[model samples]
Target chain A: MKRIALLLWLSLVLPLAAASDAHREYDAMETYEPHVRGDQSLSGSYKHWAHPGKLDWRLAGNPEENWKLNWKFMDPPFNASVHGGHFALDRGEQLFRELNAKARFARCLGAGKAGLKGLRARYPQYRADLKRIAGLEEVIEYCAAREGRVLQNGSYDNSAVSLYVASQSNGMPMRVDVGKGVMRDAFERGRKLFHTRAGKLHLACSSCHTHKVGLQLRGSVITTPYGDAVHYPVYRTRYFLQSLHLRFAECNLDTRTQPLVPGSRAYTDLEVFMTALSNGYPVTVPSERD
Target chain B: MRSISILAGLAVALVLPVWAQGLPRDAAVNAAAPNKTLEPRVVTNSGRLEWLPHAHNLTPWPTLSHEDRRPAPKPRKARLAGPLDGDAGRGRDIAVRPDKGYCIVCHQIPGEEWPGTVGLDLRGFKQRQYADAAVYQQIFDARVNNAQTVMPPFGTNNILSEQEIRDLVVFLQSLE
Candidate 1:
């Protein structure tokens, strides 16, 4: 009887002890201050030599203006509004509504169309029940699974629906909570991963994004990580719509490091860290990029 | 009963190896065994046999997904003891190749278009009058001077060979 009582007492107390230890680690962590400000433009003064012939000479003096012109020039053909119909946006909206109807996403999210305002800004959130950091994509995948449907993380359908839902919260600032629990741990891990140098090049994400921000690399300019996450699920001329994790994988490959699986815990943790840096920046889905 | 069973088990264990030695060794198994003396097998890709660099051929580096317990290289300063005798032209070729030195990725080299501005412009590097050994050390490991430098340790990390570093030094010294 005494042994049974001791086992129960140990089980109850052990978990509490472990929880406090995690909290202590969180308390000891140094606060991360983003290097780049929200207002600062990521575009640098470097001449866009990737396609010199395509550049408008009039906007040459102002790199920001030149970038805008270059971005507009690279807009996909589907972006055109034919006879008052915005094809890309309409398709995205249609797919989103269809998925919502099938999966009851409106009920699951505890919001209607109007109530979904600022919904996109609150993602890469820590779920107490799930006991892991869940990105917007992961949450959507979970909801879809409940309805007996599968939504692959980086697929076109996923991107389309995500872009549409994210567009709803367009102008709202990101508000990822990293104050307590597993979120704090994930944030710490993400920051470490970003700064840690690995691979054949011995390059950290900070090497290009933080240290070499505004510097040109061959034909392209390096952008700051701050305010960068806001415009993700961005439509690129090279590969239509791309998820943030997909882009992370591409960066991993560029550094000659084998990429972690998309939507994996490590990548989700990284997304949490990255999105937290853009805390004050407004979401800008359906954004185009060259 | 236990002693009789134990005796039988001991007898089987003692006879097992001896009984196996009487059998002929499989020729295929002997052929399949790894031999250090044998040349690396060429892989056939799209109907063409090529000596591509596989995981076995490449130098082991610390990768993101893998946990590397090896101690990281510390910043150190070392100089060549003799006069540099590397081919400047060959060095220039290596500097431009993306897979090799690719110095133009971060440094502005003369005659190179779309040069990156992350590192110092080497247009008049000859005028700096830096010692050849100093330049070699900087390329090998810039952390010896600046601990927070973003430049890759080309020599120390095995990204560039010592001869390649010597050639790069010669090429960098020739800039006027």
Candidate 2:
């Protein structure tokens, strides 16, 4: 009888202890910086630029120097402009207002644009009514469905609107509530997904992002996962206007794992896990990557 | 009555595919079907294309998912007792190729450009004087020596064959 009681006590206490350890690791990753070759001044700036001809001239000089120059030029732009128009952000805002007009998101979410402000920072939270964790994309899709519209996850319209909504919370620190309820479960699942090795290569996300940060994989440098969640719905040179789930799918393909459906429970949980890691970092959306 | 209903369901299930085959091939196959397999379409320079069915039917490893807490494969003993007779040239090729050993991704091998600095530099690896079998075992599974190693179990996981690991061993031994 005593052993049974002791076993029950251990089961209840062990998970709580493990949760605290996970939180400690999360705190460490939030501030951890991996060393990489680049000018520190050009880290997060968008205004720093060189003329196209001069940039080309420098790129032609040395092959090794070009790799460094690429990183210097690849910093996320503050306002990503493509073909003389902020197409993604503009389209996103238009869709957000349109969806709002049809669904009256202002009624439930908040009134006016002020309600939209800092909204992105609190997402991937447990929605008690829905009885599950909901990311911004999932919430948007749910609202869209009520208006007799189908907004597929990772679709262009979905990404664009998500980008706009996320842009509203720009400069606000991300604070995903992983303290209680289903959110804690989701957070734990996300952490496991991030560290678990899968697919043909048997490489976990941490194998490159954490263990081999700043190291070269083929031609590209492996980057740290810190502050990465800030820039979602980002435009990349190879893939224009991509959502975070799309990026996850791309990573899954790279590791030869079958990609999960976007906005699925697992992916949303992963978003929550990753976004929580960037707790103090300001949200930066619609950024460009190379 | 239940048996009759079950027989009717089975008959319909068997006939459905046959009926669908009368339609266009593309229309017959539901794109959203979960188990639908796709063929690799290879387009030639002349714009000619062919669908090579099952050409890319590579199955993912039967490894544990993120939720599973199962430990990875244990280290195995070395297959051979002595130095393997492998082509050093082929071993070098395997080490440098991105799809194969990709040793250059972490190890800074001699005369390799843009080698990563994650692992120790292997310029004077030959001077270490380790036996060829030891090197072979290390490449097969580094977890034997270091339980917490980030290195993948190439042999155990079937990422590399015995011969490929042997080639890698020869390549590493030749590094100077």
List model 2 lDDT by residue over A8-114, tens digit each. Answer: 45554555355334211111122222111111322321112222112343543554444433333333342335521146778778877877885476444433556
* TM-score of every prediction relative to native: 0.68, 0.69
Docking class for model 2 is: incorrect
In the range B1-176, model 2's lDDT, one tens digit per residue, is 55555555555555544432222232112244443323222221111222232312223332222222223355666666555878788888888887788888888877888887777678889999998877887788776786556676778767788888888778788877
lDDT (C-alpha) at residue B153 in model 1:
82
| lDDT score for residue B1 of model 1 | 56
The sequence of per-residue lDDT tens digits that candidate 1 reaches over residues A66-161 is 443323333223233232112344565776676677547755553555667788888887656466678877776676666666666665555665
**lDDT at B4 for candidate 1?**
55
> Measured with DockQ on alpha carbons, how good is candidate 1?
0.12
Candidate number of the best lDDT: 1
Runs with alpha carbons beyond 4 Å of true place in candidate 2: A1-85, A103-113, B1-59, B62-72, B81-83
Q: Which clashing pairs does model 1 show?
A: none
